[model samples]
Target: MNSLPKRIAKEIERLMKEPVPGIQAVPHDDNLRYFDVSIEGPTQSPFEGGNFKLELFLPEEYPMAPPKVRFLNKIYHPNIDKLGRICLDILKDKWSPALQIRTGNFVILREKVLLSIQALLSAPNPDDPLANDVAQHWKENEPDAILTGKDIVRFSVSEKMDLGIRQAKVD
Candidate 1:
């Protein structure tokens, strides 16, 4: 409880001063530990021309534990589940206490996740996926899967789905 707040405050200050490329994150005024985040879809991925929203919270154990993060925007990715839960090793079983920063409680939150997800966008790992059907589809028919993912992006935009990243603000 003590370390978490101080850490989060430092994190907010850092991010505000040096925002990450393609990603912007800010903590809510009402809840210092809960952040509203946005990540631009990578340029060459099916999600390009889009913005993705996410919510991240520092748990009580914090650096000793990973932040609870989930996508608020729907995306067509094999490593992301229907509920927007991710199957990334860093976010899960591989999380390291060394990720903790003496500077902030946020860990290297935005950078690591952004880079990894960007990499995932460029080169999806279908062998291990949170969305099983999508993974199987990718494995069985790579080209068709790519086509379908692209189609989904187009349709979602036309349909005005809640796929756009929510503006970062105190909520």
Candidate 2:
């Protein structure tokens, strides 16, 4: 693998030193720009108690362009599509080169990508949604939609656990 950019290397080092709560991002041995991320669902949300796996890739453009992040596991969210594409402003037009990965009670209110994604899970926006059907479900019957999300979270977690066990046995 080629050497990582200085900026990316610093960011990764900082991330390792001062880790964010409820979020873990580890780089691949071969590719430092690619991260295997896992975020625990926020409490009081439908996805609570679930560990959502996601992949984050820092492109050549890097801070000039937003990192590409998408869920690797199933998630029932209005802002998230079937393909795990997230409909978040920061990931798109709102992206800024100055954005960092810090979270919680910072002096500046600058947006942090992963933290913003976690916040989105806590407060979903049905009006602007990637998953039209899920958004409609949220708009029409929010309670039912939340219940469905909870069900999906439960199932997804269990399925992941089972897969882990099987892999462990194989190993």
lDDT by residue (tens digit), candidate 2, 26-64: 888888888898899999999999998899999999878
**Clashes per prediction?**
1, 0
lDDT of 1 by residue, 1-171 (tens): 244566566666777888888887787877778889888777887777667788888787876787778888777788888898988887889987676454644545656665676667767789998899999999999888877777766776765544333433323
TM-score of each: 0.82, 0.88
User: Can you tell me which runs of candidate 1 are displaced by over 4 Å?
Assistant: 1-4, 100-107, 160-171
CA RMSD (A), model 1: 5.4
The window of 10 residues in a row where model 2 has the poorest summed lDDT is 102-111
In model 1, which range of ten residues has the least summed lDDT? 162-171
Name the best candidate (by lDDT): 2
Candidate 2, superposed: residue stretches over 4 Å from native: 101-111, 161-171
